[model samples]
Target chain A: MNETADTMNVPRSRAWTLFGVFAFVALIAAQVHAVLTSPADRDMGHLQKILYVHVPAAWIMSLAFLVVFVFSIRYMWRGQEKDDLLAAAAAEVGATFNGLTLVLGMIWGKPAWGAWWVWDPRVTTTLVLFMIFVGYLALRSFVDDPERRAQWSAAVGAFGAINVPIVYMSVRWWRTLHQIQSSPSTMDSAYVLGLRTNAIAFMLIMIYFIRRRYELARLRRATELIADAAALGGT
Target chain B: MNAESSLAVDAQRIARRFGARWCLRGVSLQVRPGEVVGLAGANGSGKTTFLRVLSTLLKPNAGAARVYGHDVTRAADDVRRHVGFLAHTAGLYDDLTALENLRFAAEMLGRSPEGLEASLDRVGLARVANDRVRGFSAGMQRRLALARLMLMHPRLLLLDEPYANLDAAGIDIMNAVITEVRNAGGAALLVLHELAPAAGMLDRVLTLVDGRIAAEGDGPAANAPTASAPTLASAAGAR
Candidate 1:
């Protein structure tokens, strides 16, 4: 039993570390480019630089939610417990980035929009989603048995994930306090290239973070099971 | 892997891990058509894990499990179409009435509800079919779950602790159900905590300990009191 836990524990491989390094390097290069070449936005000025991180982080929020959606649906259809865990790990990472997106959006808005926060449709709906997933994760943590936790969490994840689109579509449907989306096609070549590079960098970084987080989650679960067995007097 | 072949089940060195710990390790069991096998184990002895692996709810890390010669890992959808799994909680929606729950499962399994009433009556839940599962007693909930087995008419049945909350009469009803399945030339794996009551229904008994099959032998001793099987007691003590 002791050996079983160790065998299943995911080691942080050198390749994973290297991937992390490359992601950070790419991020720094994009940040440097955004800082050095691009002129201040006529409207937003220096606040635009925050866009490099904030937009990508926001993009990750949805991408991560999508991961939860896919895994949750698969779990429901097939009843695979691991799919539930994968969905849970993705939800945690998504919640982290979603929070970052919210805070960074505020930091940008304080100067440009003259308000620290706004009850815009996108922001409000995303906040609701963040709360829903937060509840999802909380429900998972509160449960003791693995099977029960998986079943309950998968149910919540599948139902809660429906809110992701509501967040994006909220901006389009009713009048919102948030700004309309900036047109991607209208961007200058240089600005677009910078944004694209940073987006890719952020995506790579997001992948690393989610993978590392998943491994950590897996290890933590393993260690906890060992401790539980020990508590039960298993040798 | 052809769905039409009618192979019962073949598990090859199936190992399942939970995080870093093994829930079941290098475990293998086979069941052929018309076999009623009882899986006897103490708590945490990997009985549920083994069932989950067979049901395609959890994949084994290092081996293959197939139902009807359908590889659970690769041909899971096909395997699921043939197997009906019942966990401790019945896996039924608490808010849904018995009929609704059966209807939902029927739709998901692609089984028509044309004979759902017959299934409910077979499980003795037709009288209370309109009640939400939350209002049902444990025995009632279990009966509703068994009704699911009847409605689907699956080729293989996996029951985990199906007798947990049942009274003596309920156990008889359950045994009748298992016997009916066997009579139809289907296979059933019943995970049980005690063998005395349901031992007669099984053709053989397989014991589990520490995530592996500890013993595979004849059905529980008929003349002896079934309570003496210390497997569950030992497991409880281990915990």
Candidate 2:
């Protein structure tokens, strides 16, 4: 058991380091490729460059939330502390990306729709998803017991996940300022390549962020256990 | 296996560290079936940490603990099944009545609520079983917690400061509950600050100082005054 745990730790740290370097290179490459290869849109010109950032951020935000949902369920089902930590890590990363998506969307909207903010279904539901997880993080902070916190947060994480699909479908379900979902097949090949490359870069960065966050969470739990032991003393 | 063949609590070279300090440094002890052992320790001496570790709530930083030969870390589910832990707090929901609290515990443990009323009566809380715990005195809440323990009938009892906040009657009830558990061939590790109150009920007493066992003796030996040792109550208060 000790050997397995030790071996796993080495690989995980190395993997995170590799992901960090790769993500940085991929992000720069994607940006350069999009600028040089993709033609300016006739309608919006260079403003369309924002899609490379906006769409990928939105995709990764949804992906991160999906991770939270899965890990939260696993925590509840298996009652493992690692699962709870992973869920928390995913939620934190997801919240950051969700915020980025909103900001980027707003920036894009300012030029495309002549408004910085709107009550569009896609925008409103994504905002709600972000707020729900923010509330979930706040709830975790308020609970003192580790077990109780895991149980409550798992419930909140699961409930918050229901909003992900709603946010994804919102643009299609309603006539909104937000455009319908786009796919690689639906867009010009160059635009598709740029978007895909940026998405991969963002995904790698998100994984690295969540992994590091999980490490911090584990360290915090260890410190808490030690402190608890110190406070209580030996019987 | 017979009760005598199985160890109720067996902890060996246990160590739990916090930052640079060790709260439980190579502490080890054992309790057999039908034995009631009292643990007297100064504040922050790691009494509660030991109990929490044995109860499968906290993992020891080193060494191993077993209840009936089931390792705490490897078989926590089995350890949990055989152990009942009552901390200084009642661990009860204030909104629930005494009866409701027991019912909730019973449900969580997957045990029927058939004997909850009897258990409440045993703890002298039957008269106020329907009263909300929010309105109960500290002693009453403690009794309700004891009632919950009685219903569970765990094979090993880990009581941290069981005498805390209890009146004379409550103390007697707590003693009776411990005696009953021993009489049924279960074992108990009772963590206390004062030896005088539980001395008569203890088969043996272990004194902890600086996170290690300083001494071990029977009831009479515990009552013998030691100039350097401070009672748990005094040490706890100083902290």
Assess chain B of each prediction and give its TM-score: 0.89, 0.90
**DockQ of candidate 1 (2 decimals):** 0.08
Worst ten-residue run, lDDT, model 1 chain B?
A: B230-239
For residues B168-239, write the lDDT of model 1, one tens digit per residue: 877888888888888888999988776666757777778888778887766645214544345444532321
Model 2 lDDT tens row, A4-73: 2222232246767877888888888888888788897767777878889999999998899999999999
Q: Is model 1 an incorrect, acceptable, medium or high docking prediction?
A: incorrect
Please identify model 2 stretches exceeding 4 Å from their true place.
A1-26, A66-94, A132-159, A170-190, A197-235, B1-5, B13-26, B56-63, B71-86, B91-137, B140-148, B165-170, B226-239
What TM value does model 1 have? 0.58
Name the weakest run of 10 consecutive residues (lDDT summed) in model 1 chain A. A176-185
> After best superposition, candidate 1 residue B239: deviation in angstroms?
17
The lDDT for every candidate, in the order shown, is 0.78, 0.81
- Tens digits of per-residue lDDT for model 2 on B58-134? 87767788899899999999888889899888889999899999999889988987878888888888999899999
Q: Which stretches of candidate 1 lie over 4 Å from their true place?
A: A1-235, B1-7, B19-21, B91-136, B165-169, B220-239
DockQ for every prediction shown: 0.08, 0.10
Q: Local error of candidate 1 at A28, Å?
A: 9.3
Error of 2 at A87 (Å): 5.7
